[model samples]
Target: MIWCFLTPVLGAVVAEQYLGRVKTILYSAAIYGGGLAILVLSSLPAVQETVISLPGLLLSLFLIGVGTGGIKANVSPLLAEQCTSPGQVIRLLKSGETVIIDRELTVQRVFATYFLFINAGCLAALASVEIEQSYGFSAAFAIPMTVFIIGFIALMTSKDQYNSSAPDGSIIPSVLHALGITIKHKGNLNCTRPALEPVESRYQEYPWTNSFIDDLQTALSASKVFLLYPFYWAAFSQLLTNFISQAATMQTHGIPNDILPYMNPITTLFLLPLLDRLIFPTVRNLGYPVHHFPRITAGFMVCALAMLYAAFFQRTIYVSPPCYDHPRSPTCMHGQVPNDVSVLLQVPAYILVASSECLASVAGLEYAYANAPKSMRSLIMALYLSTVSVGTFLAMAVLPLTVDPKITWMYIVLAMAVFGAGAALWSVPVQRKEAG
Candidate 1:
């Protein structure tokens, strides 16, 4: 999983320096399809009986991770780049009120819609799980493999339709050079020393313009906003790990414990359109637009609330009958008898976390794209995506507390940590500047 997140950094550089977004996505899809094909073949009964299947499965997963990283880093920025308008435009509403359509708002809605489709696609997970259970692992793997083949064909037919940026020269050396210049000038980026100095007096010619410096500053400022994301992601990670474990301790009524996490995507599917079509428009019409930072802060708060609820829910499970405080007790047959609590009760927490994804996760994508320098969009996005890897590490650090008894404290700590991060985000001067 960490490799899945980290590979995007390299993928982004590849996208920026050599292959354009469309080609990168195509190549990545090809690699991903190959992995899926390998997976499907490896799951066949004959191969499953052999040691080769294990290595094949591992290799497939690694290839899939690499492909996923490449796709993730490029796709969102590609979508954003397709939007023609980059500035505000005045338009008349049906109600005869003239209003300014902000490109930032359009980007936000685009990302929200993008996220909606992503989750809709995630419904395949539930379907695949059922297929694996009923048909076979090979059949389950074959489904997505077939879908990817079709999707790749569609992309191939429509390749020229996308608005793609050509690979500019690599930005890494330029960024490093600019940073050195900034440090030499005692952190003053506005100085014209690069342009004004004689060529003979300097070790190298300044290849970047003054505008490039401005863009670099914007990218750096945007990077600062991403610092809080790891905490939010760390809290969100519980949905996959500890949340499933919590469900296992409760009465699932013959349902799979892992199935409940799908509620996050299910709730997101319902909420995205409502937020995009209704809530945001209504709030904007009321003269209070929820900008990206406040919207993300709201997401952080929602995540914290989910954690708080989970903490209380964990406490309830601990105090519930049969196992009482220790669900794994041998007296209760070592988790054979779960607590009397119904697993359906976990739905609200999942819903809250889903809401946070709509708010924080989608908005973070929009923020990254909108604020990034045109040339560095993929790089900035990869940095934003890396937060998930960092958050995974944070979750791993707390794995010791994921066991019974300590789990409740884990939730509490996560809640406090996320809320504190959100508060810090809100207090950021740039957030205030944007809000004002």
Candidate 2:
């Protein structure tokens, strides 16, 4: 998971400098397909006992991580780049009335749709779970491998239809040189602006313009906004790891423990259209605009609430039945049985997390793309994605506390941490600046 998040930093640079977006995605997909194939083969019953199995599985995971990183860094930027319209336009309708179209809203909708399909794809996890339960791991892995191949083939056949940007020859050196000049001038960014520099000065050594400096500043501001995201993601990450363990300690009633996590994607799928078609429009018409900062702040609060509920729910599990504080106690048939609490009760937490993703995650994507310099869009997106790596590391640091008695406290701490992050994000001066 860390690799999945971290490799994107380098992957974005590669996409921008060497392979334009389309080719990067194609190469990444090929590598990902290869990894999935190896994963399928290694999971087969015949191969599981062989010496090659573990190494193959490890290598496959690494390739999958690298491939996912490349795809993640480029796909959203590429999707948004497909819209060629101006930011705002005045047009005449069929009824001879004039109307103004806001491309920012269009981009927001595009991202919402993009995020919707992402969750829709995640619904395949539900299918995988069922397959794993019914047909074993080999068949389960094979399904996605096959689907990936189909998707790759489709993309390859239609590659010429997409709009792609050419590599903007490396900008890192110019950025570094500009920053060096800024520092030399006592932290004045304007010192590097082309109009302000002397003819023979080092600033003139580069070809960057005043607008590039402004864009660089804007990108830096966006990065500051992203600082809070790691805390948000750290709390959200529990859904993938600790939440499954929580389910195992509850009464599943013949349901698979892993199945509950699908509620997240299900909730996202249900809510995305609702937000796009109804809620956002209704709210805007009612004279309240939900901008990125507010939306993300709301998401943070909602995630905190989810964690708070999980904490109480964990407490409820501890106090519940044949084995208080330890659902898997030896007294209860040596950990063979769970407590009386129903695992289905976890659905609400999943719903809240999904709601948070709708707000924070989608808004983050739009915000990053909207604010990023044209040449640095993928790089900024990768920086935004690296927050997930930070969040995962945070989760790992607290992982030892995920044990029986300490689990409830862990949730409580996470709730506090996320709420603090939201408060900090809301209080940031940029939020008020954006509002103004």
Candidate 3:
């Protein structure tokens, strides 16, 4: 998993220094397709019987991870670049009210749409579990392999539609060269001060432009904002790990245990359209600015509320009949077969987390791109994505509480931790004057 997150930094470097976004995406997609094919073949009964090996499985995963990281880093910025508008615009509504169509907000909407389709793909992938149970793992793997191949072909068809940039040839070395110039001019100690302006002689001696220095400042500020993201992601990561464990201790009635996980995406699919078309526009028309930080802060609180609900749900699961003190007991193990409370009860938590995604997840993507220098979009976005991995690592601090009755306390602690992180994030200064 760390490898999955780490590879994007390399992808960002390659994209910015060697290949532009379009070529990088195409090349990565091909690599990804090849790796998926290898995975599909490896999972086959015939291959398993003949010569399945852990090394082969690991190699496929590594290849896929690298390719995926490349795609994840570049694609959002590429899609966002499609919107030519760089600032907010005012339009007269049919209701005789004025509405501000904000570029940052528009980028947020684009990312929301992007995630909506991404979740749609997830919904389809969840369906593959049915295939895995009946037709076998080979067939299940084939489904995603086929889907990725089709997506690659579709991307190829639209190649001419995208805006592309040439690689600037190794950005880090250039940054180092500029930094050396600054250090020589300003002295090493004063270079770290926020108020220190770049010495004019340094710009003349080095190729560093005023715009580059200013943009670097913006990029650094954005990176600091990204540092706060891991808390929200750490809280969100529970849906993928611990929340699934929580679902296993509840009654599913006739539903498959795996189906409950789909609720997050399903709720996201429903809520995104409502937020984009109605709520946001209405709020803007009412003379409120839906700034990224405030929206993200709200998202953090919403996620904290979701965790609060999960804490209560876990408490209920602990006290409920069949499971009683031991949710992992022999009878309680199947969850579908023997459990006290209905799984339907987990719906509120899923819906609340989904709401947070609309606010927090989309806001993070927009904030990364909108705040970054055009040259640093993929790199900055990769840094933002890296927060999830960081948050996951941070979550290890609470690993001891992942079991049984202790899980309730775990959710409560995470709720407070995430909420506190959100408050801290809200206090961090943003470069709005620089942004303007």
Can you write out model 1's per-residue Cα lDDT over 274-342, one digit (the tens) per residue? 998999889978999678888899999999999999999899999999898888567677658998899
Instruction: List model 2 lDDT by residue over 167-227, tens digit each.
Output: 7765777777888888888988888887787556844455887888988888777788888
What TM-score would each prediction reach against the true structure? 0.92, 0.92, 0.89
Worst 10 residues of 3 by lDDT: 187-196
Q: TM-score: which is higher, 1 or 3?
A: 1
Inter-residue clash pairs, candidate 2: none
lDDT of 3 by residue, 305-399 (tens): 99999999888888888767577576555543445788899889989999998889888888888888888888888998888889999888889
Question: How would you order the candidates by lDDT, starting with the best?
Answer: 2, 1, 3
What TM-score does candidate 3 reach? 0.89
Quantify all predictions' global Cα lDDT against the true fold: 0.86, 0.87, 0.81
TM-score of 1: 0.92
Candidate numbers sorted by TM-score from highest down: 1, 2, 3
Q: Which regions in candidate 1 have their CA more than 4 angstroms from the true location? A: 86-102, 180-193, 196-203, 429-436
